[model samples]
Target chain A: MLKTRIIPCLDVIKNKVVKGVNFKNIKVMGNAVEMARYYSLSGADELCMLDINASYQNRKTFIKTVEAIAKVINIPLTVGGGISVLDDITDLLNAGADKVSINSAAVKNPKLIRQASIKHGSQCIVVAIDGKRHENKMKVVVKGGREITKKELIVWAKEVQSLGAGEILMTSMDTDGVQNGFDSSMLKKVTSNVSIPVIASGGVGNLEHFYLGHLTKSTGLLAASVFHSGKYKIKSVKKYLKNKGVPVRL
Target chain B: MKKKVIGLIDGQSGNIGSINKAIKEIIKGRPYQLKIIKGEFDNSLFSKIILPGQGAYATLISNLKKLKIYKPLKKYLDNNRSYLGICVGMQILSDQGHEDKTTKGLGIIAGEIKKFKSKKLIIPHMGWNSIRLNKEDPIITNNLDNKDFYFVHSYIFQNIKKSNVLANTHYGKKFPSIIKKGNIYGVQFHPEKSHKYGLNLIKNYILKS
Candidate 1:
């Protein structure tokens, strides 16, 4: 039986791991390699290394960061940020990344998702959508959650799924650093619209939020601030989920 | 006694570092000399070869052709030198791949690699999956005992010979997890990433060969 995944997002800047508040005000955490090793041993199902400085850097630092982390951790790693082309996806996959995630790039060029899914397997491509509620509707944001796209969250999710994105990682920018809880309303809307696996991201402060996220039909749960700041260890979270009758791997 | 040189093929399609680590862990403190070979692989120096990959099947096959090692690999296999394929490397042993529809594979194994069609199961069957041994094959039987092995593959081999199947796993349906026919063997899961059982499998492979 397939179990729900517990992913920890690591923001990388200039080859160092950092955690920020609401995707800004970055604070250094530790070496990328060291942090990756710790996460692997600490029972993280998967690791996502988001190159937060991708838009600023001409060349994406995700591949180098993935290569550095791949040396230590043997689990699956997903790389995102500034992944615009099939070549970018190819480079990351070749650099030991199991999956390549596209946020702003996929929103700009929808065909890149199809092209990448065709060239590499759909499982290799992950479509990440940053969402924020606007005008009583969840709106999709791009470019590190700065630019809002003129697309509805549910509509874009269905489009990406049709474009061969095997999974969707939807993050709520509004609830990201607040940790009030996951955007259950947004997650419910988008997951109901797409048939592919939906990974709920942002605002995971406590074990109860994780439970609520799973109840919203999310196949996976991702967190950065909560896990990085030592609010709860991943192993303890998994144990709690198991105790709560959630179908989590212990 | 001549040391068995295991050729680690590196065609730049995927990282071979973890595979090398598995090999080192398998050999342990023993004085067995294992050599890592790159570029157009010359199989003359090694008794057995290990092909490991992590990317698209077409890219790996294309790169193998570009390096002009595809024919040599086939020739080595024809001569019955032991060959082991891991992950995408295992998928490329088939006749064709669905990822890139028109791309041809090494055809070492008589099967086609197709995307696992399941609305319920994830495309890539990631994480630890238990392998049920079909028969008492020495490679896995000596090490693993119905334990979970880590798997991360989008495409799985279809229409493979039952005689070659050493073990099977149930994702949506029971599929071949480990296939072995004579000196050629392929594991759909990554034994290197599977912890104790995986390393034990690798140890068994190194010791038996």
Candidate 2:
């Protein structure tokens, strides 16, 4: 059986790992390659690096960072953050990323998901949805959570899956970087709405939230702050989840 | 000693960086040489062949055919020299694949790839999963027996011959994860991305197999 994946996400900006609250106030974490290597060796099932700022100058550095990380680590790498075109996806993959998650681009051009999946295969095209509860309904937000689209969370998620996306990376904006817990309710809703594997991102504080990650519909649980802050090692998290009857790779 | 040349078949559709980097790292200071076989490659030039692909079955087959390496690849593996396939690379070893439309595979291991039938689990069985060994090899030393490997695919080798089955991973059903017929070894998981155990498997194949 497939085990639940404990992924440590690193937000990248100018080729450095960073953290932000609600996708703002970015703070550098560390060297991208070093942290990525550490995470891979530390038993991270997969590593996600979002190029939080994918500018013209940052693109080269981001790709360079990806190449360096790929050279050092043997596990899978998923690179996101400001991926807007087919060429960008090509460059990232060519630079050694295993998968590329698209958010704003995918929302703006849903056909890009189909085209990308057709070109690179569905397995490599991960559609990342940033959901925020506006009023009473969860709506999709894009552009680093700066703009909220009219698309409802679940409907847009199902659309992407039908558009040939292999997986979904659901990040709740409200709870993101809060260190409270993963938005399990929203995660469960998204996971239930889609047939493809969903990765629960945004909020994860402790072991309970990690265990709750397994209980929810998500197959991959992503925690940024805990792993970035050095409060919890990925190995310990997996062990904890495994002890709690979650199928994890140890 | 003769130079052991390993050819990584690049059909222009699949990602080969991680695989390329992994093999390069393992074969450092060794007698092995890695070659990226893009278009037409002389099959005899390679002591071993590694084909790593992704995407739809039809697209992968089309890419292989477009590069004009499909026939030569099939011919090369028909007699079974040391070979390794990952994901779509493994799927293409089958006689046919039923993803999207019925398409032809290498017909090497005598099987057909089909999507998972059970709705209880996710379609693409992504993430790490442990395998159950069905057989062992004395010549080609791969310690893949019951070891966890990373897998991401919706299709499984369902109609595979029993003799060809080497390892099976249970998701909703007992599907063949590793299939070997003679010297050809095809794993549904990405050994290059499967961490330490996976790298060890590649190292074993390169040094021993």
Residues B46-164, candidate 1: write the lDDT tens digits.
87788877658878888888888788887887776788888877788787887746579877788888878887665566666778888886688664756767777777889999987
lDDT per residue, candidate 2, A1-250, as tens digits? 7889999998888668988887678788898888999999999999999887777888788888888998899888998887778998888888888899998889899999999988888899999999999889999997657788899999999999999999999999888888889888899899888899999998899999988877887999998889989999998898888788888888
lDDT of 2 by residue, B45-156 (tens): 9999988877777888888899998988988988778898888898888889986679988888887888898777887889999988887764224555777899989988
After the best TM-score superposition of candidate 1, give how far the Cα of residue A248 lies from its true spot, in angstroms. 4.2
Query: CA lDDT of B127 in candidate 2?
Result: 93
What is model 2's C-alpha RMSD? Answer: 1.5
- What candidate 2 gets wrong by more than 4 Å, as runs, is B138-143
Local error of candidate 1 at residue B172 (angstroms) = 1.6
Candidate 1 clashes between residue pairs 3 or more apart in a chain or in different chains: none
Model 1 segments more than 4 A misplaced? A55-65, A84-95, A115-121, A245-249, B1-3, B11-13, B24-29, B32-40, B54-62, B95-110, B136-138, B141-146, B195-197
